[model samples]
Target: MTTRRLTLRQPVMDDAERIALYLNNFAVAGNLARVPYPYHLADARAWLRTWRPDKPAGETGFAIDLGGEGFIGQVGYHLDARGETVIGYWLAQPFWNRGIMSEAVAAAINWYFRVTAAPKIRSGVFHFNKASLAIQNKLGFIETGAGNLLCLARGEQVRHIDTELERSVWAERQDA
Candidate 1:
């Protein structure tokens, strides 16, 4: 999906190197659950290989290109065994506070609801990552009182879980 400020497209092999750099930043890595501190190219290549876009229940990653800046971040949604679609994303530190992520996520969420009949998209943000929480709120995702523990890049334990956004609520927000 494409937006005025960003384009959300599938990850290409060439994106691995850039993604590895984005993943390696300690500031960016600290907010995510699985990204390693010193994320390597090999790790990025392995991740690219594991991606299966054709699977009925799978996670699809997208490169968030801010026109001239190449890929500033990545976002995606995956179907869990329980049939819930979980959304996740990470942006480069330099791109933070620019409203880029909000636009990318809004586009992704709209596309997901359009392509599939899923009623809602779920997201969990690490507690310390207030920026993520703000983004979710900006997207009209209400906290459903859910929370869980997640391991960070530094092997530090963090509580990183929350909220669900039903289609009805999303529609209402869009209408407003």
Candidate 2:
């Protein structure tokens, strides 16, 4: 899927270098639940090898490619252990505060809702990640709860604020 400033495409081997370059930064990896800090090219390669377009809905990902830049980040969703499909994303630190992630996430969510009958897309952020949480709020997500989540990069559980966006709400926002 294409946005005005991005091309959301399936990840490939060639993207490993860029992915690692961005994710290796502690600032980028610290907020994510799964990514380990000091992320390596090998880790990116292994992750890329797992991408499959045909995966069940809510279990797939897209490589976020900027217009001039190549792979800069990722936006996608996954089914949690509790059987909820929660959206997650991370952009290169250099691209922060530019509304790039907000746009990419909005487009990805639209595509996700289009392909599945899921009622809502769930998401959240670490308590201190106000920027990320703001992006979620901008896209119509609302706080649902709070708890602690394991951040692999941090190697510890951190306070988390849960959020959710319903399809109807997104549809209304799109029409606006």
Candidate 3:
């Protein structure tokens, strides 16, 4: 998906170096619940291996690019046993607060709702990560509940806010 300032494409092994370079930063890893602290090249390589570009949908990840600058972040969804899609994303610290993520996420969500048959999209963010929460809210997600998750960067469990965007709500947003 191509936006005015960003492009979302399937991730490949060739993007590992850049992915590692950005994810290695604590600021980038800290907000994400799954990314390990001191993210390594090996981790990037392992993640890229999980990419299935040909898959029609479900749990597919994208590498976000900044026009000509190349990979700057990652976004995707995780499909659970019950067929709920949990959206997730992370951007390099250098690109923070630039509207890049907003654009990238909007594009990803639009594509997901367009192609996937899931009833709703689910997501959760650490309570302290206001920026992420705001992004999800701006995209029309509503608070569902709260819970705790093991944050790899913090190396402990942290309070989190769960949110979801049902297909009906998403359809309304699109119509508006």
Candidate 4:
């Protein structure tokens, strides 16, 4: 899938270095639930190797790429522990505030809804991650409830605001 400034493509081994470099930053990884602090190339390699073309949309993701920059970030969804389809994304710090993440996530989610029969996409942000929550809100996601999710970087549970975007709602937004 392609966006105005990004190409949502599959991640490659060559991207492992870039993924590790960006994800190593606490400012980026701290907000995420699964990424550990001081992220390493091995982690990126392992994560990259997990991707398979045959996997369902919920188990696969897109590598966000720019024309000049090879890999800037990632966008996709996965099944949570409870077996719900959940969308997630992260962009390099240098690309922050550029609307790049928002664009990439939008494209990914759009494609996800089109290709699957999922009723809605589940997601949320750590309480302190207001910027990420804003992106979800802009994409038609609404607060579902609250919970605690473990942040590997923080080494503890953090307050999370759960949200969801129904397929019907997404369809309405697209029509508008």
Candidate 5:
């Protein structure tokens, strides 16, 4: 899916270097629970190869393009057993606080709900990550509960802060 400020496209093998740059940054990785710091080119290639497009079982990734500068960040969703779609995203430090990630996420959420038959979309932001929480709230997500143990690839435990947005609520927000 494409937006006025960003374009979402499938990640290519050549994008490994750029992906590695932002995914490995401590500043970026510190906010995200899944990606490991010092992310390498090999990890990017592995992720690209493993990410299946045809049978996307609720989990899908996109490269966020900021005009012609190439991939600036990534966003995607993972489906849970209860049919809720959980959204995740991160932006390069250079692109921080410019509303780029918010645009990318809003686009992704719209696409996810329109394409899939899910009843709701969910997202978790660490308590310290006020920027992300603000973006999610702006997109109509409401706080649902408290934190949980969100696991990371680097064997670190992240506090899973709360947020949820039902389809009905989202529809109402959009119509408003």
Candidate 6:
């Protein structure tokens, strides 16, 4: 999927280097639930090697590509046990605050809803990450509740603000 400033493409083995570069930073990894503080090329390679774009189930990963800037980040979604699609995304620190994440998210969510029959997309932002929270709100995700999750970056359980965007609401917004 192409956003105004980004192209959301499938992750490839060669993207491991760029992925490791950006995700290695504590600042970028801290807000995420799974990525460890010291992200490595080996980890990136392992992840890319296992990615299945043709899979009938599970999360689909996208490498966020900036036209000339190369790979900058990732955004994707997977269905939880309850059948709700869970959205996840992150961007490199140098690219932060440029509205890149917001645009990538909008495009990903738009494509997700179009291809899947899921009713809503669920997301949780670590409480301290105000930027992510702001993006979620700006994209029309309303808080459903709060919970705690183990953050590998922080190596502890942190409070997370949960939110969801129903397909009906997104469709209405698109129509307007």
Which of the numbered candidates is closest to the native, going by highest TM-score? 4
How many collisions between residues are there in candidate 4? 0
lDDT of 3 by residue, 31-86 (tens): 98889989999999998887787865667878899976899999998875567778
True lDDT of residue 144, candidate 3: 91
| Candidate 1 ranges beyond 4 A from true positions | 56-58
lDDT of 4 by residue, 58-138 (tens): 888999998898898998789988999999999999989989888998898889988999999999999999999999999
The true-structure Cα RMSD of candidate 2 reads: 0.8
TM-score each candidate: 0.92, 0.97, 0.95, 0.98, 0.91, 0.95
Query: Candidate 2: lDDT of 36?
Result: 96
lDDT digits (tens) for residues 13-106 of candidate 5:
8888999988887778778876766789888899889776674635887889898699888898776556667888889999998989888988
Estimate, for each residue in 83-151, the C-alpha lDDT of model 2 and write its tens digit: 999999999999898899999999999899998899999999999999999999999999999999999
Question: Could you give candidate 1's per-residue lDDT for residues 29-126 as a string of tens digits?
Answer: 88887787789999889888876657442267688999888988899877655767789899999999989999999998888777777778888788
lDDT of each: 0.83, 0.93, 0.88, 0.92, 0.81, 0.88
RMSD values for the candidates in order, in angstroms, are 1.7, 0.8, 1.3, 0.7, 1.9, 1.3
Q: In model 2, how large is the Cα lDDT of residue 53?
A: 74
Among all windows of 10 consecutive residues in model 5, the one with the lowest summed lDDT is 147-156
lDDT at position 110, candidate 4 = 86
Model 6: per-residue Cα lDDT over 22-113, one tens digit each:
99999999999988878999989988888877954237868899999989999987776676668999999999989999999998888888
- Indicate the residue-level lDDT of 49 in model 1: 84
Residue 171 CA displacement from its true place in model 4, Å: 0.5
